[model samples]
Target: MPQKFALKQYLPNSSRLVYGCMGLGGNWQRLPLTDGDIKQAHAVVETALEAGMTLFDHADIYTHGNAEETFSHLFKQNPALRSKMVLQTKCSIRFADEQHVGRYDQSKSYILKAVDASLKRLGTEYIDILLLHRPDALMEPEEVALAFEQLLKSGKVRHFGVSNMHSGQIKLLSRALEVPLIVNQLELSLLKHDWVDAGTTFNDDQSKTNRVLGDTIEHCRLENIQLQAWGSMANGLYTGAKIDSNRFNDKQNAALLATKELVTNLANLYGVGKEAIVLAWLLRHPAKIQPVIGTVNLDRIKACAQALTLELTREQWYQLYVTARGQALP
Candidate 1:
């Protein structure tokens, strides 16, 4: 039997890369979007499409919901593009306002309302996937399941997933959900390095306090859940961003420099840009991780697309891992 919500079942043609919409609506402020913002967004959308990246990851709270609003312009101008795209947006993380503190919401009412608002903003009748932006500490699984049922039945959201959640939480929620959760988005990159550490550090002292994302990578893989990576480029830390050496200790500084050098060497060896090498690190994982990139630079976007074809050998992958880990693996 096939898994109901597996990535292949729903997004068979997903480019294994996602264009993050957080950077689409301009700066994080209350002001209205200017013409320049929409123009910039068009470049990202068009470039990403050209690169074969059809999934656009968004969130209800991204840029005060302006990100989805901005993206809707493209679909409005060309409705045909909607059929060619897979739109996934997140909800639940709320900003503080005059009446309430900023918080994570998983209440049934809030979930339904958020979807309606997001649908309106995106100008779409349905969302290919709706993810919870973050876990709610006071989440009630039964209520959330009810909301999911409504969304699924009404054809507002076709699929569901989450961000920043662990394996146990996913299991608890899945027991109540009618359809399987298909994705888990997280901060997985060479710079963060904790996702790899969490898997390798079990039974070692390093696992005691260092494991923030406990076995999530393994759990997602075992469950056949698609893992999408955010911050996968590490803010150009390993690629080309100028480092502030003063902020790191001597050990950290050495690791940073060594990793950057290795990335450059591999890029030249592979005949592709450095972005491909960094993204390929995540792609090399057996879990088929999809990286979400936010760069709008035309050349840089194409450079990132190259990762879809670049294959790093086992030796090179471990070499990058050990250098970034800053020490021998446990």
Candidate 2:
């Protein structure tokens, strides 16, 4: 018999794994952006729903808001699919150039306008989940609270969260906001294990740049906030790099080969793909991490769905961690 699906209560009781759609409509140049591409993207959404994925993730800055438009077009084509799934989109972070060099805005005016435009682009009555794509250094807690209250009252958004923020940031926002901030999406993977190492200090300044693993995860669990992991594949940093590739170095290549071997072995044991095993490692954490996967390929979507079923043993989990870090527990 198939194993029962595990669901985490993101809010009071709503549960979803949250599929990231950053590559779907937003990064059209990298993926496809035409009307035909939009139609094909819808098929992936359908497949995800069929496989039990109920939450769709997006951001306004993604492909300069083209992702939301693509989703809107899909909703227009199949109006009924709206009721079957939860829609989540993010705001903040404006870009002046296509290279995405600009400012992060949390001003009430920009947020309000951004949400209105997002709703219009999504062709939806309400966004099930809304997140601040990134924190603004100039954000006023009271102003954010007021904006969230207004949106909640107007039925424009049902829930709120943040992306790429720390515990102190979440605390600051929670103090003035009445609505519960249900999630924090960040980068987490075996290769990026700082979330698990909490208070441990790394001497290498370069490694320290990205190391916040242990404290962030612990704080989220204590606060009843879900950890949504993006770049779960480390942006394919370890997939496979040619020896001459810029990203490929002796140390990095060794770690990648080790991870590839571990993932392949687990995939065979679980009857899934290596990618699924990679994702499963994140799910295996006690912090209740829900991976936000961005894929335009249907086979990849199916593989991701299968990942929900693969379970890694404790030894196997640590093996990958040790191999990636080239060190055992301290």
Local error of candidate 1 at 315, Å?
A: 0.7
Instruction: Give the lowest summed-lDDT range of ten residues in model 2.
Output: 4-13
Best by lDDT: 1
In terms of TM-score, the best-performing candidate is 1
Check candidate 2 and list the clashing pairs: 194-213, 195-213, 195-214, 198-214, 198-215
* lDDT, model 2, position 316: 84
lDDT by residue for model 1 over 1-330, one digit each (tens)?
A: 211224776788666888888888888887797888888988889999998888999999888988999877877888888888899999999899999999999999999999999999898999999998898999999999999999999999999999888899999988988888999999889988788888788779888766777878889988988889999888888888899999889999999999999999999999999999999999888888889997767788899998877789999999999999898987
lDDT of 2 by residue, 151-212 (tens): 99999998888989988889899999988888788878876777665544445544454564
* Predicted structure 2, TM vs. truth: 0.89
Model-by-model lDDT, in order? 0.88, 0.76
Q: Which segments of model 2 are wrong by more than 4 Å?
A: 1-16, 26-33, 97-101, 199-214, 237-244
